[model samples]
Target: MNIDFTLEKYKTLCETISNSSYTTFTFEQYFNQENPPKNCILLRHDVDRNISNAHKMAMIEQRLNLVSTYYCRTTERVFKPEYFQEIAAMGHEIGYHYETLDKAKGDVEEAIKIFGQELNAFREFINIKTVCMHGNPFSPWLNSNIWNKYDFRDFGIIGEPYLSLDYKDVIYLTDTGRTWADKNIRVKDVIKDKDHQKNNLLIGNISTTDDIINLIKEEQYPRICLLAHPDRWHGHLIDWTGELILQNLKNIGKAGIIWYRKNKN
Candidate 1:
């Protein structure tokens, strides 16, 4: 039971809202609607693998009687046309997972050009509307990695949640570097104002898996969107927990190196 907690935690969170008998459902069916049900689980998947971990997460959500949105990168390493049709077949919303700034690597102008090109490529297979940043931690820019280079709304995009949400009001949760709320690196999907700035783009951070469960228990907010990487949640306990632990370790080590170099100078 102790060993099973990590795997059980995410599953339990899914089951609680889906259960209905134990807890009632509270999610608005549309975006930006006032009087939202309470907690809307926007299960997001960022794909970079040839085979999608997002697909597996979608399957788990299906078991819980839920659906989610998946954002796949159009880069050579992550591109797969056949899988697009299959994922769309599963009834999940398909989106573009973009890392244009990283693609440009400090050239904001080139990043914009590449973003438009990538956007064009993604539309070839699926009807994509929403987008989420790939969270390229090493990049100096966050959402601006792509958006700062260009206006996504001009491309017919409805909303890019990472940029659109004010984190102060909506609680922001992500599986970046495979941990819950990490303090060291730059997180791309930060819509929250942690300083308690009201009227700004607000998003709260959930530091632990237990925090997520407790929120469901307490019925904290009216709207919440969880950003998860398909690469993080592969469904199997060994793989999921292993990835989370290993990735966070890598991030910690990277932070140590940066700190050492900064102080050495």
Candidate 2:
């Protein structure tokens, strides 16, 4: 396991911000700065954990004088009233991480019908104004198909960022493929820049956590979108490592299935 430059880069970025311009009072000004600071850390949490890694991550960010958004899933392994309230109290943004397609299992109508129920339920705990789709990595479908049928804003969601904008305007980064550049994974759904302005939409593959840290240091502050699975990042290294292993195994299985089908034909 060579050094994960992605994580190291992120750490460096955080440290640079802390030393050069970190302040309890200035935090507000920092984000609003017109020139932009070169890097904005969009720490996103896909709340899929059995334990409370989201809570711990929030605590860590708080210690660093940073705040992030946490998107909670409201299904099988989902949103609890107590957990929702706790995250809200931390003064962080709470949004929806939905998978109605998975819940509906390819039935578009069924997904929409259930989405209404889930949306109503989520409102009981928090006023969720924004949403992001839970990328069902194993599914052939990209984002939950239900999102394609209707406008989330009508359901009181301000935006589902991924579907709402072109990635070129703001760089799209995520912990997808267990590392950024999972070559086998081609995200066909998310819009990419066709103008060849790769720098503007720097969606490069990040193989290590250090990639994130490094970006925080070098780039000019551009609003970034990051996807993290709380279910994947357990506080302990052992648990985190195990989750990655399982994810890799699932990917392997998917590849094997593809290979078998190709040979059988």
Model 2 — which ten-residue stretch has the worst lDDT? 22-31
lDDT of 2 by residue, 55-168 (tens): 765665665676667777876556677777776677667777778777777778887787788878889878777677776655765555566677776886655655654344
Error of 2 at 81 (Å): 1.7
Local distance difference test values of all predictions, in order: 0.62, 0.60
Instruction: Please list the Cα RMSD from the true structure of every candidate, rounded to 1 decimal place.
Output: 4.4, 5.0
lDDT (10s digit) by residue, model 1, range 64-100 = 7776777777777667877777767776777787787
* Model 1 lDDT at residue 162: 62
**What's the lDDT for candidate 1?**
0.62
